[model samples]
Structures are given as structure tokens and as C-alpha cells.
Target chain A: MTRYFEDLEPGDVFETSGYTVKKNEIIEFAEQFDPQPFHVDEAAAEDSIFGGLIASGIHTMALASKLTVEETFDMIANLGGRGMDDLQFHQPVRPGDTLHVELEVLETTPSERHSERGYVTYEQRVLDDSDAVVLSLRMETIVRRRPEGQTE
Target chain B: MTRYFEDLEPGDVFETSGYTVKKNEIIEFAEQFDPQPFHVDEAAAEDSIFGGLIASGIHTMALASKLTVEETFDMIANLGGRGMDDLQFHQPVRPGDTLHVELEVLETTPSERHSERGYVTYEQRVLDDSDAVVLSLRMETIVRRRPEGQTE
Candidate 1:
């Protein structure tokens, strides 16, 4: 889905394929990056406030970032990103959790720096199998404008 | 630093030791996660707008997350993050870029849902060797309140 800035309208919603979090993968990612007990030690995590092994927030973010590109977000002309805002983690993502993502276009602004590019801000939500929103944020992306005669 | 919610003042600022980005690490990260052409393929990246290989934004987030725990954030009371807002890729992170991070406490709000915990928002910035901000975000975290008679 190579979409251009001009092709995206505010209020457009894009959904992604489901991704499952595995227990080992959670620990692996945590050990390699986050390394917190709740993330790396299953037994310790069970005794912690989280009640069990939980995926690191960065892992969740990586999944979201990957889905944002795989499901939509025109990659060919995707200039890059400005940043994300108002990020909230509502729930801890556990192993066996199957996650789905939704990206809703919130606003679009023509680029002041380049006529060939513009900024698209989206509200990205990561929902668990139970449809609970585990994570949400407003992500701003730099996407290219459509060139003449190009269709995507 | 064992910081509790009450210990985190809104104006508090913390700096982190640097982490250098490696070319192989960047490719490995992208291969397992993002897998974008510009992120995974060096030759493809050379022809892209970036003009060379670049680290995935998610990779940068992961490094920042690791440093947050290793360098500053109070671990014992550090409940996992809620989410990040206004995450921006201010500059492309290239191989060999030595990155330093700064964390500034933005605000603290006691949790209405749970009296034992509160939310602390930090503005996290990753600056390259040149002192240019490459990535920045507002990260929200849930931290436990100090127990009675606890001293740190």
C-alpha cells in the first residue's frame, strides 16, 4: 500500500494484520534491550506488580512501528518522521496476546520546507485480543506528495 | 537512582552515557523487525534519499529505553511506560553515530485509578556526537509512590 500524502485524508483509518507476542521472544527482547526483572525473569515478574512476564514497552513500540509501515504508510515516498505525541500505555502486553493495530489520520499539513512532501499525523492504537487498547499515540510522519501522472 | 513518584520533580533533568550505533546492529535490527529497504539493504540505502544506511527509528527508541533504565530511571518503582508522545526523528541516525541522551521530567500526576502509583512524563532527547538532536519524545511512565518510612 504505497500511499502518498495527497492520497490520505483526515479520518482515514488503516488496520494491520495481527501479531502475537511469544513468551520467549518477550524475554529475549527484554534481556537484549530493556532487561528489567519483570521483563526478563518470568518467576520474578509473577511476583511483581505486573503479575507475570510482560513485554517491554519498546518491544510493543517496535511492533507498532513495523505494522505502521506494513499495513499502510506509503513507503516509497515516505520521507521520514517528525515524532509522536501523547503516547499512553494503558495495559501491559503479555505473552499469548495477539495484537492488532489501527492508524487513524488526524491531520495533514503541507510541508513548508518542501512542496514535494507534507506531514501526516496519525493516532495509532494497539489493541489486544480482547480489544483493549494497550498502547496509543499520535505519530507524525513525513510523506511525499504525488508527482504528476503517478498513480499509487 | 531509586526515585519514587514523589521524588521526581517536574523540572528535574538527567543525562545518560552515550551509545554508538553500529552498522551491523542496525541491519540486524531492521532485518528482524522493520525490514525496510533503506534500513536493511546498504546498496538500496545508498541510492535512497538518506544517501546511506540509516538506523530504524524503533532501534533508536530501544536504545533510549535501555539507557533510561541503565542510567537514571528508578528501577524498583519503575512500572512499565504508558506510551510516548511527540516522538520525532529530528535527524537520521547513521552508523558510528555516538548518541547521548537527556531526560527532563515534564510533569507528574498521581494516578486516580491506583493510589499506589502515579504517572511521570519525561521529555527524552537523543543527541548525536555533534550535539544535534536525532530523536526526541515525550514518554509517560507509571511509578510507584514511596512507602512510609522509606528513604532513598
Candidate 2:
């Protein structure tokens, strides 16, 4: 069931299962990587603009990446990511929120430098239980092409 | 000396202290948020395209965010992030590599909706110990405007 670059087409869509955001996990991750007041300290967060503890945007992105990898990348010949564009944090992710990802293929291009691999451009929208897009981004990834003699 | 919106000018620059990438930490972060074969399983990684286990791009980004917060955001009247653009992972981050961030203000715009805050656009470059750019992105954040009667 390994999907190569040739198998993905523009408009192909996939959805990932949910992961519930936990307050302790958020604080732990923020303490290690972000540590913004609103992300790590409940008391400081209460006085901040967010008015409560919230997951760091980087934490949300990581969550989205995890869910996407579990649902899709693990099933494909994904080499790695190249870059991302236009990442938007539409809504604050709270401790109790359950998040999932919906992704759609936007384009595929054969690599000029590598004949064995190609590139896939996809848009991922991370949504909460309420179906609101909490975060979104367009990612470009390297994917292996089907082998010369391999038939699907 | 809390720097407000009015205090940040285009071209202002800051540099953060370095953090060395640890193998165990990279594996731990990947296990939680990425879990790609090349990111989590060492044997699998050696056979993969990257040739070895490497830090996840998201992990690099999170590191950059932490460094920025420690170096600049903690000293500012910062509100929160709005969005990011053109995030490029220029190089793989390997264990034992030290990383730091250099950021420069790109622009500032008054928020049309919130008189109390303004927007600051900044570009951050995460560089390895060799000074090679490992990751880069532009971020937009909300910063409190200098309050009335406050002179500094």
C-alpha cells in the first residue's frame, strides 16, 4: 500500500484521526520549545491577551505533522519535507481541544536533480472538534517515484 | 525595559544563545510529534534517503521559537503570533549540532482593529554552529503599543 509520487494526484484528499490536546503536554512542550507565558504558565496566561492557557502555534503544527504522518506519510514513500508556505494560526488551541487534519494534494513534479524521486505539494488544514480550522499550511515534500520495473 | 510596538523598528536585530541538538531528545521529539522512520528508528534511518537520523523540521522550528522567546520576546510587550510565511528548511539538523537564531524586524503596521496593539513582521534565521542557515521563516506578531502617558 505504499503510495509513490505517481499515485498522488491533485485534489486527492485524506483525513487523519484525532489527538486530544492536554494541558500538561502543552505546558511541557512549551517549556521545552516555546515557553511563552500564555503557553506555559496558567497564572500568567490568565492575564495575557489570550485570557487562558493555550497551546503554542508550534505545538499545533507539530500535532498536525504527527497526525498527518500517522495517517498518510507512513503509508507513502515520503522522503522528507522541503518547505512550507503561508502557515496560518486561525484559532487558539486550548487544553481540551481534539485536533485532526484534512489534507489535499495540490501538485506533483518530478525532481530535476533526482530521477528516483519527485515532489508533492499539499495543503493541510488542522481542525478542532468544532470543525474550525485552527491551523493551516502548504507543504512541499520529497517522495520516491515507483521503481522502473515495479507495477502497482 | 519592556519594548513595546513603538520601540521595535524595521532593521532591529537580535541573536540568541545556542542549543546543542541531542540524539535522545531528537528521537524523543520525533517519537511524539513526527515518528518518521528516518526520525525515530536509527536502523531504518541509516537505510533511508537521509542516511541517518535527523531532527524533524518542526523540531528545528520549535527550537528557533524558544531561542527567540528567550532572546527577544521575553523583553517585549508581546501579545501573540498572527501567522508565518515562507518557512524553508535549508538543511537537516543532526545530533550534536548546535543551533542559534538571528532575527531582524522586517516591518511594522498599526492594527486597524486594535488601537492598543500593532503588528511586527520579523524574519528569523536558525543557523547551525558553522553559521549555515538551517531554517528560516517570517513571522507576524502582535505587540502592545506604548500606552498613553508612558515615556521611555
Which of the numbered candidates is closest to the native, going by highest lDDT?
Answer: 2
True contacts kept of 1: 0.75
Candidate 2's residue-wise lDDT over B4-120, tens digit each? 999999999999999999999999999989999999999999998889999999999998998999888989888999999999999999999999999999999999998999999
Candidate 1, after superposition: displacement of residue B60 in Å? Answer: 0.5
lDDT of 1 by residue, B15-110 (tens): 989999899999999877787778989999998678999999889989887887777863437776776777778889999999988999999999
**Tens digits of lDDT, candidate 1, A1-114:** 567888888998989989999999999998778888899998889887889999998899888877777766534367766777787888999999999899998999998988
The Cα local distance difference test for each model comes to 0.85, 0.94
Report the C-alpha lDDT of model 2 over A11-83, residue by residue, as the tens digit. 9999999999999999999998888899999999999988999999999999999999988898889999999
Best-performing candidate as measured by DockQ: 2
Query: C-alpha displacement of B132 in model 1, angstroms?
Result: 2.1
For candidate 1, the chain B TM-score comes to 0.94
Candidate 1 Cα deviation (angstroms), residue B66 = 0.9
Candidate 2: misplaced stretches above 4 Å?
Answer: none
